[model samples]
Target chain A: MSTVLTQRMIELQGLTKRYGDTLAVDDLTFDITPGCVTGFLGPNGAGKTTTMRMILGLDAPTRGTALVDGKSYRDHRFPLHEIGALLDAKALHGGRRAFDHLLCLAQSNGIGRRRVTTVLEQVGLADVARKRAGTFSLGMGQRLGIAGALLGDPAVLMFDEPVNGLDPEGIVWIRTLLRQLASEGRTVFVSSHLMTEMAMTADRLIVVGRGKLIADATVDEFTSQGEHWIAVQSSNPAALAAILTDAGATVQKVDDSQQVRGLKPIEIGDLALGAGIAIYGLTEQRATLEEVFFGLTGDSVEYHGMLGSQNGQAA
Target chain B: MSIADTAHTTPARTERLAVTNHAVPTQSALRAALVSEWTKLRSVRSTVWALILTSAFTIGLGTLFCWAYLNRRERRGDSIRSLLFDPTARSLNGVVLAQLAVGVLGVLVMSSEYTTGMIRTSLAAVPNRTVFLAAKTIVLGMVSLVVGMVSVFVAFFVGQAVLDRDGLGTSLSATGVLRAVLGAGLYLTLIALFGLALGTIVRRTPGAIAALFGIVLILPLIAQAFPEPWDVRIGRLAPFNAGQAMFSVRYDPDLLTPTQGIFVFLAWIVASYLVAMVMLSRRDA
Candidate 1:
């Protein structure tokens, strides 16, 4: 089947949302381009959901604009066909059958019923299509939500925490689905608080904190910003540490292992061999995405509880 | 099951990735939204039960009242010609119960969306808020009008059949009889619309239903507690009293004429609908 590639983009220009005194989304400006998955990363309460809501026109922006393909989402004649969003999995009347739930949304956008059946099959929900939505488990509900998103065959798809209640298999299915959608030249923007999850699924990351843009870069670029070091486990730890230190490398000895900086693993190995100190293991390490996420949003975490404290006491 | 397991089971999954680009006929937004709302209303179980109860209450209670009234007149040995009675009004009295059923159905149509957090999904689908609300109103209005007419007409026919056994029944050809019957159906439809407006404004099922009952039923009783002319003056404007004037053939100085009652009832609905429209548009889903 031939696929037509359209310019599907989500552009937010200084989009601001203020609820009374609290600014939920403060001057968020970014563009989500097509042909790749852009991960919307932020800590909890960092305004990720609020920004998505504004983009979908579920909430009015206090200041600036959120445009989908050069037009506001509300301005689209058939919005579901232009951009589909799964804001909340449970945002449907549970008394209705799963098929009927998707049917109504499809009809609203002038989509055919055949497409509804196709989406149900695509999401692996065809088996339970006749069941009431209220009886569905979280994973089933998520699949049903995805079916609704795919009903109109939209160009741009947005999912707010799409994998919240998925099992391992479901997670793998969604990850594959998201990457496949992006590979097909459709714009796929997914929001998640899990940095590790984004690291695996997103080609690009748009990180935010306290409703402010923090970093906008590729996944490799984001990981490269953190500290890098080489871990050396040697038979002669003391000798290697002294040799590595003398060779202009900062080395810290801990439990017969030397953590070396300012030197490559190959350099340390060559130096250790030259010094006649046998090395058992030479491994390079970089800061994990989880650590990098925390380091960037540390000051912006809205609610911080005392860690490892008992009986409401400060630690 | 793992991703490999799913892939093995569904080898045809690759075809699902292709988005259908077939040409579809462009429909008006209002028509699309109307079709969506109709599907949403019928898919739920509550709508079926509510509509069934509406018809059953109207027909069943009307038959019962007609039978009891005839039995009572026979026991009193009063001639049907000597007594002053509005048989049409008496037969259509079941509308009092039927109104609540229709009102509940109306309230649920709008309020359930808010309660289920479905408003977000709904508004996202039909971003034009005016068109969304208009479609919902049109669908609910049409359904209630049909059901109301069917219920009231069946009640009128059956009640007359029972009363006709005693040679005391009124015909559609009688003076003011057809208007009263038609007015009963119109009154129920108005009540349903009133409930829908309240549901949109309140956005909660229980609260909207309470407000509906308070305005339609309790307010009339409260109005009757006023002193002398103030009592009748305030009472005549209440929805329950206005509805009574619409379907009552008997002339009374304390009540409005059928036309006057319709105008008064319509004023109440218009005021509530305006507030509902404002709240629906301005508030976040």
Candidate 2:
């Protein structure tokens, strides 16, 4: 496993896809290394699926290359052995039984039927192996997709929006499965628009916006980069706001509280104490992962809701 | 990177195989794809049902037609043998209906993948586009050929047996009789390939079927409306009429010879396949 992991890596360099006048994926580059789950974060139409398709050689890149372990995916003699990807779990014939569906895929890659049975057992679909895939619940369908990815037992695995419609139990199952794959030294790259899913499952993140790279960093780094603010509640709000503005801290009044930036909670406390003003409360407001995601993708969101239109008031 | 040390319940045997340095000796790319396609073709209920209907119509309708003809002969007080009526062709009259069944089967084999988005998974596993397409063709062609031949043979024998009771049937040992049966099967196979090519080109079930039926069935009828030498000239070139020339026992001035008819059928198949290949190779899945 270690030997396989050391040699397997996915690299994309200046990869671009254009459909007539629209640029789908524009000049994006990233490397997915083994032994970790790298979350690919992007909004809808951000080229996440396009990039994944290019990596699998399903769609050609108009400009650059997507390489797996130093070679194009098309060049690999045993593609499934090198990389097993579940681009869309629903990409299967509904009329086929689950076992037969996986069997054909396994046979295409020269994998044994025995492995098909094993994967069925592993995904907990053993009892329903003879059932038609069309009848499966969304969670069962996802499990079947993961079974296909593991059929070849490839060194690299990719799942696009794997937990899209899964129940809480199914989502937890996928999280544990992804972590286990990473711990086994497989390069596990998963793509999703949901930030919370990535926060719980991903060790590193490559965030994209408007088909371009926005942030590629560790989860800790990504979360910490969002600006933090210090919130202070004071009896004399206008005087405290003036003092905070004078002290080089940006202040915004919200209801009865004043939000201060560029200053720590202790610093704001000290300022209020020195100015002979009583502070009701001082709290540090750290940005949540969702906020960090929105901040990075604010301008790139193709479909965004109005900030305060829900209540017909501006924020 | 320590899969061996993991405490998860994944099968230990597969882990060993996964960690191995070399792949097991497997079939070549094309052969494996063929095997995969064969597995896929047989596993689907649609394929089985389509082939069953093809057989049922070919044999069932053939018997019905022969029985109806026998009743008409009795009423007319005609002799058992008629020089004008070709017993061989009448025994295989079911080919007309079976053609649609075989054509639909061919279309579904390729079009279902497109509709269900299974083509992406298929192409990802077998990246060589030409090889993948060829494998699909091989599997569909072989299955259609075998089923078509069996269905036509059953139709011929059963229809002949019904006619034989009145001493009006042609035997398999007869020279033109065997050729007609074999030709009917060949025609069915060619029609299936034609349907498959159109399905690959159109990438939709209804559109491809409509195109296939339009060219093979409707165009022939439309061509008959033309004036002067144009009708016979265009009619002979129609794929369906040209292929029917294969089963004819007597020569007609308006119809093509067996050899010429086969060439025209082959031409249509090759043309459709070339167009399909170009489209499949160039397009994104």
Candidate 3:
């Protein structure tokens, strides 16, 4: 309960990183405000993890600064007592027992033994704590890593792809834990390739593509923008377009067929029925962050067309 | 900056221990880092075997070398006292390789963090870079000390046993014997520190190990192959060959003596460690 809290928890101001000729993080600037689960969302190579590394002071920024609580991570005397992170869950000594690994980390931060056990219990790993980490399943490792992150009860926390190998139950557990940590006035910034997971867990989303910030807004706001569109289908496509146009809605042709981009699905459906357009198929379409992503990402041709996506996961 | 901190300063010296006030400025952070690293060391079973193997190899080689070299050098000398052995020098012959083992282990203890991306977690937990590196140096240095002592002592006993067979001995009371033993331990410690520096610089286990071999093994070998003046010139600069003088019992006026060689070894260790700190500060882990 005595979690030492710091206000500006984590901040990145115009952070940039380059590996030889390639820039991995490009002039990225964002702040992880306290008391919320700010979801760091991106496609492969979007620099979420790179930003995390810079924040932790593991990577020296090429251009700008990454600060934790208004100071650099290097300035903190007892950093673990203030912040915790699971940058990579598998970044562990696989041969050591879960208990020993957590205990050692705890000892480094001057956290007591009782708190180790408590964190283990909280992460539902108390029984498996004695088991060597190598034998644990990936989900178990993620849990153990999360347990380690909580060992210090720091006011700020970060996790990079924490659910990569986790099961549904483990994912739920982490989502709840992250939300709970934030509720206790801790800053929680988590990065994930799983957009759907972030949609569910993160109150706010910071979207990036091609190592640049695409959007930083509430989840609700992102989802709201895409809700006005309707997918219309009919044999008399031109007739339908004409009617929709007459209704003061914008329409475009997609794939030499028909593209409709205005009004609710129900309104379109009613209009189509009344106009005897003989609809083949009709569905409501929301311009989700996913769709906005598609629209914005398709334009990111510099990397896609020039170099081709090269990480294990393709663009 | 606070009045509170000033007021809490220690008063005039007293017999009673003032653990809180008199502790080193960065000791707690250093201690925390040591604890973290020690945990990491024990978590891997390979560390135990590495220590055991180093000691066994050093002792076995020292004994073998002592048996062969002693029998040949003192075979016909009949002063009786002339055969008195230097247990210290004979015992430390294995350190040449044993130090490599401790050095490799020290390198892995750190560089592996970078190779595997665990450095992110480690640095995030303990963000003060200088304090973190200082703690690593202290803890790893201490481990190397203890391991080096055990290996050197074991080599001494085994070598002593072999010399006993020939009734040829090296005097443990000799002027340089104690210094050699201490030097052997100090040498191993320096090697470990050098390994740590290499680890920080290369941030790759294989690269660091290769660099170590190049510095400690190749430089000396390449130096010897050169013509006289070049050999002497390069030999003076290469670290281990110069540092090895510390463990020798006999003084050679033609070469730098054991005592003088120590300063070079220290210079190498200090320079490398400082370079490591610089690279560590600037590089992306």
Candidate 4:
């Protein structure tokens, strides 16, 4: 019966998961801290879900243990009261009414019926309280899920893509909900594929790429870590890459552009002006979370599309 | 939280699990789980159809079949006249069909959580995943057993009346008549539990149904097609053949014996349940 703060923390030490021969999670070691919304983030197939599964004791970690509130999730006498999670929003039985679906879960956790009514109202499902769950919209289901997560009002709350299917309004609702939970001194961890969404919601980013922990830092720290961040709209990016490289500043190839590493604006302008590559436009760019995520995960993304659907490869 | 996002991400200062020991809710954990499950079951419109259909099919069809059989039997005179008519089989005629209903019912009880992706929500509420699973099985067992038994009883009286019209029936005093009819209720209850066991093991609708049917119907069909000695032996081990043995007035020497049949049936149920429990223990929600 330890508080989440006094507990040993939700630690993953040298965790690895292998399916047949392929490694799904490779030597993952990170602590999801209390009182902050730690974004359990990665592009598709980066093993974010796999890692979460390990923490919850859903997937066996081949190498080490993932302690949730000092003990494994299974070891907790009342795991529900300790940590609440939303792995998938639509995991409810379609035939069940939202009320019934929540009721079953409430009963299992030993919550009262009045609490069920309270949650239904909290999630804004009170209007359709008696309706079957199968008929609910995606946003409605997400709301119901959020209500269930709040039912135990646990200390540690984890959400895997809680906004995946929500509309704009639902999205805003989740953002506020997560922020509120964290502010209330509860640990809130959420995983998402969208960097934009995470940018606005998560306080810390645990970026994973190709089953490896690529970056685990605050947004400022992550962006600042990469020295090579440049925004240039030029007629000659090829010539720019050469000019920036020759000046002793390592130029990293970015999408349809180039990043001048270890160089200030004056240094880049001096090199570009001397090299006869007339830069139509050159702007100093502070690293954004998106740039850092894409830069770190560019090579490992399974698919890339024009829309934010995929990261680097075509389907 | 980060100091830079100044918009949202704030430096994370670690904290306690909200309040304290006295902060725990008044109701216990298990009671809450049961309440949630009850709400889940009654809230669904399909639950009503699923339960009602099983009883009506088993009982109603049982009476109709008995009436038809009696009419045919009256046309011909046969020794052991009363024994020739097995009200047990007639009363339990709907068992096969109702089993499918409850089987789908049971499969959905678990697999639907996976299908709809609700297991995460369920687990989040009650983080002890096995406790969530156990609570579900308990609910399923309670409802299905009650319905299965009730359906069997209704089927018995209705079928008896129809058979009596053709002068081929006797009162409950008839030798094995009462035992057969009542045994059928037990049989349906077991079948529903069998479905629960299969649901836990297979964890999918098609897979669970196919597996249940394969053991109950397909394996028997395949075993019967076998040439000789191996045929009778393998057929007897199959679940349906063994479990259905009690329904017969006189045991078929070619098939599994009465006591052996029950043992075999019980063995299949126990083995499935154990496998399910072991599997449930290892997997994360």
Interface RMSD of each: 3.8, 6.6, 15.8, 8.2
DockQ for every model comes to 0.45, 0.36, 0.21, 0.30
- Using lDDT as the measure, which candidate wins? 1
What are the lDDT figures for the candidates, one per model?
0.86, 0.85, 0.75, 0.72
* Candidates sorted by DockQ, best first: 1, 2, 4, 3
Task: Summarize candidate 2's per-residue lDDT along B1-285 as a digit string, tens digits.
Answer: 121121233332335422334554466888888888999999999898889988898899989998888877443555545556677778778888888989988888889989999999888888888888898889989988999999889988998899898887888888777887888899998888898899899999999999988998898899899995999999989998888888766666788987888889899999999999988877888
> Which parts of model 4 have CA positions greater than 4 angstroms off?
A1-9, A226-285, A302-315, B1-35, B73-75, B79-83, B124-133, B173-175, B227-236, B250-258, B283-285
User: Better model by TM-score, 1 or 4?
Assistant: 1
**lDDT for each residue of candidate 1 in B168-257, tens digit (9 for 90 to 100):** 688898888889988999998888889889999999999999999999889989998999989999999998789888998877678899
Full candidate order by lDDT, most accurate first: 1, 2, 3, 4
User: What tens-digit string does per-residue lDDT give for candidate 4 at A27-130?
Assistant: 98888887788887788888888888878777778777788877877676556667777776667777777777777776676666787787777666776877
Residue-wise C-alpha lDDT for candidate 1, range A238-312, written one tens digit per residue: 888788788898998767677899988888989888988888888888899989999999988776675555343
- Which candidate tops TM-score? 1
The CAPRI-style docking tier of model 4 reads acceptable
How many angstroms is residue B55 displaced in model 1 relative to the true structure, after the best TM-score fit? 0.9
What digit string (tens of lDDT, one per residue) describes model 3 on residues A1-315?
223344746878898988888788888888888878999988777888888888888888888898887888888766766678888777876777888888877777766689788877766677777888877777777777887887766677889988786656667767777777776677889998677889878999888876788889889888885646556668788888989999989998776456677677777878888988787777666676667656655654344545435544454
lDDT of candidate model 2 versus the reference: 0.85
Candidate 1 falls in which docking quality class? Answer: acceptable
Candidate 1 regions exceeding 4 Å error are A1-3, A239-243, A306-315, B1-25, B73-84
